[model samples]
Target: MLCFGFTFLYVPMVLLIVYSFNYSKIVPVWGGWSTRWYTVLFESEEVWAAITLSLKIALMNATFATMLGALAGLALVRFKSFRGRTLFGGMISAPLVMPEVITGLSLLLLFITLGQLIGWPTNRGITTITIAHITFSMAYVAVIIQSRLTGLDQSLEEAAEDLGAKPFRVLIDITLPLLAPGLLAGWLLAFTLSIDDLVIASFVSGPGANTLPMLIYSRVRLGLRPDINAMATIIIIVVAIGVCLAGWLMMRQERQRQRDMQLASGDNIKQD
Candidate 1:
């Protein structure tokens, strides 16, 4: 089953990567294996511009989403009896459950209204796309952070408070550090979502603010091309490398944690 699943998932990608090097302009008709498409892809200014814009929006969206999501998670977890807590929590979770089309439509309407009411965001482009990405991305981040917080030992935070540490100090010294893995995961997820987005970005973006996904989508509609295949292959390679790197770091952190636990156990045994 696992092998079947893997084959089902990866066979198309494998084919895409193989055909990316095809000498022929037609995607299905493989003339011969060549690096011609890769060269063409590299030289394309429009593709490069879209890539640059996507990266910029993803970075901005990820950073802001992580920060805001962290704060929201902390509020939901720490402040147990706050007024309107239910309403706040519902609002935070809304984006996660909302359909992309509906979310995009609502945001588009919102931007139009805001533009008419106040002279802000006169034109929708990078700024609007980033904000739209952040809106949905932070919901995912908040869920990740909230789950991480729920699993954490509250005693450590309380101990810090008892030892004359201020609340902010406790958060800085204890809470945030413990939440590092979650924060990193959330940031990466947000970044990936922002870069991968198409529907929402399309609704919010202006004439010149085409993201890589939007550009790829537009090209696909025209017909498959070798350059597009090469672009996909490059993206696949980059994403695979990032995933492997993140996995390695996580494994290293887990090993270090296990070693610390062993040492702590040894020390306790000696004291006893």
Candidate 2:
């Protein structure tokens, strides 16, 4: 089943890449091989602008989501009990399970309401799009952090406290380090979600705010050209690189963790 799934997933992408080099104007066809489409992609100014906009939104969303979500995770996990805890948690994470269209429409309506009432966020462009991305991104971050906190050993924190560290110091020195991987994963997830967003972005985005995915959809609607093929190929390459890099980093961290555990065990044995 896994092999079949891999084949189905990658075959189309492989074909798209192969078609990118086709020397003909029509894409997904064989007509010799050349780098013509890639060159055309580089020369397109609209594509560049769209790509830039997407990157900017992704970076901003990742930053805000990571910081705010980490705080929310701390509150939910450390506070133990509070008034309306369940309600607040549900509200924070509701976006994750909700339909994309509903989420987008709701955000757009909120923006409109706020504009009319408070006269803020005057126009829906980058600001609205960022807010929408952050709204969903925070849920992802919180989930990641919450899972990490669940698996964490409570005694490690107690050990920190016994060593004369304050509660805030324990979090900064012990908890944050242990949870770094989850936090980093959350940031990357937020960035990818922001970059690939289409439905929510389409709803919140105003004039001159089209993202790369939106631009790609508009271009593909007209027809499939070699340039579009090239653009797709570029996106595939970028995503592949990101996945490979993440895998490599995770593997390295795992190996380092194993080594640390072994060393700690050895030290205990020596003391015994």
Best prediction by lDDT: 1
Candidate 2 ranges with C-alpha deviation above 4 Å: 1-3, 257-272
Give the TM-score of each candidate: 0.95, 0.91
In candidate 1, where is summed lDDT lowest over 10 consecutive residues?
A: 112-121
Which parts of model 1 have CA positions greater than 4 angstroms off?
265-272
Q: Indicate the TM-score of model 1.
A: 0.95
Q: Enumerate residue pairs that collide in model 2.
A: none
**Clashes in model 1: which pairs?**
none
RMSD in order of candidates:
1.6, 2.2
lDDT (tens digit, per residue) of candidate 2 on 1-272: 99999999999989888899999887756889999989888998888899889999999999999988888887788777999899988887888899999999999999999999999889888889999999999999998888888898989999999999999999999999999988998999999899989999999999988899999888888888778888899888988898899789889999999999999999999999
User: Where is model 2 poorest over a 10-residue stretch in terms of lDDT?
Assistant: 71-80
Candidate 1 residue lDDT tens string, 26-88: 999979989999899889999999999999999999999999999999999988989999999
